[model samples]
Target: MSEFQTKVSPDSETFARNRKDMLALVERMRALEARAAAKSEERRPVFDKRGQLSPRERVSALLDPGLPFLELYNMASYLVDDPDPDTSIPGASIILGIGYVEGVRAMVFADDAGINAGAMTQKSVDKALGAIAIAERQKLPFIHLVESAGADLMRYTVELWAHGGGMFAGLARLSAAGIPVITVLHGASTAGGAYQPGLSDYVIGVRGNGMAMLAGAALVQAATGEAAQDADLGGAEMHAATTGLVEYLAANDAHGIEIAREVVSGLGWKACGPALPVCAEPLLPPDQIAGVVPVDYRTPCDMREVAARIADGSDLREFKPDFGPATLCLQARIMGQPVGLIGNNGPLDPDGAAKATHFLQAMDQAGTPVVFLNNTTGYMVGTASERAGMIKHGAKMIQAVTNLRVPKITLYTGASFGAGNYGMCGYAFGADFLFTWPNAMTGVMGGAQAALTMEQVARRTAERKGVEADEARLAAQRAKITAHFDRQSDAFYTSGRVLDMGMIDPRDTRAVLGFCLHTCQEARARQLNPNSFGVARI
Candidate 1:
């Protein structure tokens, strides 16, 4: 065939028809090209400032270098203002994808802050749901780097009724699956949107950036007659120290992402069990020594510091630290075995109790063994606790412990008084082992206070004798138990009863924990059927 064909001129009518078709095709091509250009330009805005990295950049930093990120629903975009505005961003408000972190696959959703203040659109919700569905099917753990203005308002007005407002249902379903969902709160995550991270298993937050709560100060003031700043409303400190919502607090973005990656690396691919350690430390530190148990029980020690000293270095992950100031709960590895560390701080407020209950339930479900470091004054007292219903919520902790199938060990460090003693797995609380330090005091109430109970008899005797009450007798009575507890022999003998009753080993203070943790790790490994190099026994 010739390079150029011989032209056969068409009839006038036919030429006109052919021209019209060509023009229509050209117009459609131009429209398609315009759409393509717009889609190409719809990527995240340029990164500015040392503090702020784009959502994709943050996600990329978390995952392994150059890992394939297969984005879900990349073409999704919202219809703002007009029925279908010509200029609309693509990839939805959040970018959902499957990527690898440390060579292990993970389902990820990074909120695009550059897109409409990072507000979640109906399309974004669908994308998130779709990504979660993929994770569920593949059993991949989900990680969300959330930083958004919550539900997109412009697209959610009455005229745009088709645009769904919230993402509660989809996120709830993802959480219900019980797979490890790690949320890294990069920036402003407020209102209903923040709950997604709040409900997650592990929420890693930047010190000044990560915030998860019901409403911001502006909304609160608008709705109620209250004035509060963003920080006062739901800042990192509030969630960490007050609400106990944040699981891990990071120093900065780098630190936050590093911690998040560590969390994921720890989980591996398994959702049902914990990973074993490579090497076991013989004895952790001062926290487990039992020597310091009697040292000023009233002193407020950072439970995080205590847990760190006991567990393997950098292996302690505390949960709900803010909520339950009176009690401490941590998930950590001791000598390579996963164990839940529960302790008492003095007394936590009502909010603290609720947070503790939630942690207890989670720890139980994870099938991890628990170690209780008991040192509590009592349950919180006051109208706040009563109104919050500490009694009802605190019951969940007891119920969870009673129903727990895993091994539990309790060590009374100091004054395990009143309900606090019972809260931390008392003698009858079904703990596999219970131990008390030499100088520890576990009773219904403090010694000096209990001695004053016989006031009527003292008053009558004093009245008859026409003299002041005998304060010396009260001191003597209080000293009686103190003398008994002070005897090293008596302390060991009493501990022996605990040992005899299968509560704990009477000796080997710090070493016992290491041994117990090692045993637990071995047991879990066997249960999980880890890869073995040996033959079966006869």
Candidate 2:
């Protein structure tokens, strides 16, 4: 394998300009993430008065000291909650991430009760389910710091109740699949929320604070005219002694977290993977990635240049290069771990699609993780491409990606448009950990193309109606359409809507991918012990 030569010059004016633009986007992303934490901080007095730790504090206390925590969807429900993207509260009232606890890796979900009393929102449900999927795929333990206000009745939607059941169902499935699920009730877990800890392998209820009940006092009185205190109905003490639901009762929030940590430690869990070879630092610096990748995605740049900075020793063994010049399949090592990488040079034609399909199958056969550096206008469209079996070849690539036996990680680094998004492991395609760069754009098509397409359609319709096409009106319409597409395609906007995990600076790509691939490899190597059902009360 030959070392890739650097094409970008940090001293060049273009590189400087791109780096400046990229840093601005990174700053904007940081501010949005900070805003979520700041919003929760505003309710610190409420949490302090109640003698409770915030959701974040619980997660920190549960995880091992000073370990990296990969937070997911920090901007969830940002614009969805309010029209203003800047001032909106994200995280959907829940904190979700993967972190090491008691020296064992696990997924943690904590309800941000400091925000809206931790009411379960639509995106909040989606975020929790997403975390569960990652845990199941990665074969990691699941830990939940529970404190939710059930569902938001005022902002009611039928879909919220419908989709929210998946979280509890996921907990049951994880336990049945031999994955540990530890849930700690730090405060209220009312109505349907009770099933959360009920399905877990281990349940810890914090005394004087934790509450899990099928019906609260008001609900019980309204339904059957029975008068009973909520504490008597389903407090930690009641459940611990009467129902046998609380496996461990804690003195407080901090105590509950300590108990959860002990349970994880007692599981006798450890991760094992193939011994990695000594890794070499790439000749390129990670800081140079901002300069190497064009801030303006429309400006053509070789994705191989970006790969060079991340690949160990800047060496990528190119596979079937001449066959599909536009679609690249490169075998390389990142942070001492081997990976089969797919990067797009342009729109995917039949040959490119076929080549990518073959590459994916080969990687899966070898049990190597696949990383898609998506930067495509999409699958090629036209009579020439159609005649070459574009649809059939492209379908093969999609099928291969969909059925990949190996871990699939996607980075929306650049332009990811149309069916190309689907073919390259888009959000819906189950990429174990899909992410994006701040400069990335994803949609059915680019803004200019989409606007031109609609304008053409309008002009044709006008001509068919025996009316002269109004140029001024069409121009205005095209501009409007372009703005609409551009707004939605932005990485920040789509990320806030819970598109990818969240945006990252281009410079951090190597570190992020290395961490994710390491986790995936651990899952593949570790074995689980299963039973007929999850650990249940006997």
Candidate 1 at 162: error in angstroms? 10
Whole-model lDDT, model 1: 0.60
Candidate 1 residues 1-538, lDDT tens each? 0111112223345334533543443343345334534443354343354375676678778878864554444444423222243554445666666677765567778887766667765556655655665555445678888888887776575522232333444445545654567888877888767777765778887777777768888788899979888877777767877777777888877788889889988874532335534753433343233222224455454444445555655356667656655567778776666788887767755666677667777777887778878767777767888888888766766777677777777776556777766667876786654555443556666644454545556678888999987777756765774544433222223332222121222134344566445433433443222222211111
TM-score of each: 0.42, 0.96
List the lowest-lDDT window of 10 residues for candidate 2.
269-278
* lDDT, candidate 1, at 156: 74
Poorest stretch of ten by lDDT in candidate 1 = 1-10
lDDT of model 2 at residue 269?
A: 89
TM-score of 1: 0.42
Compared with the true structure, what per-residue lDDT tens digits does model 2 show for residues 19-40?
8888888888888778878888
Candidates' RMSD to native: 30.4, 1.6
**lDDT of the candidates, in the order given:** 0.60, 0.88
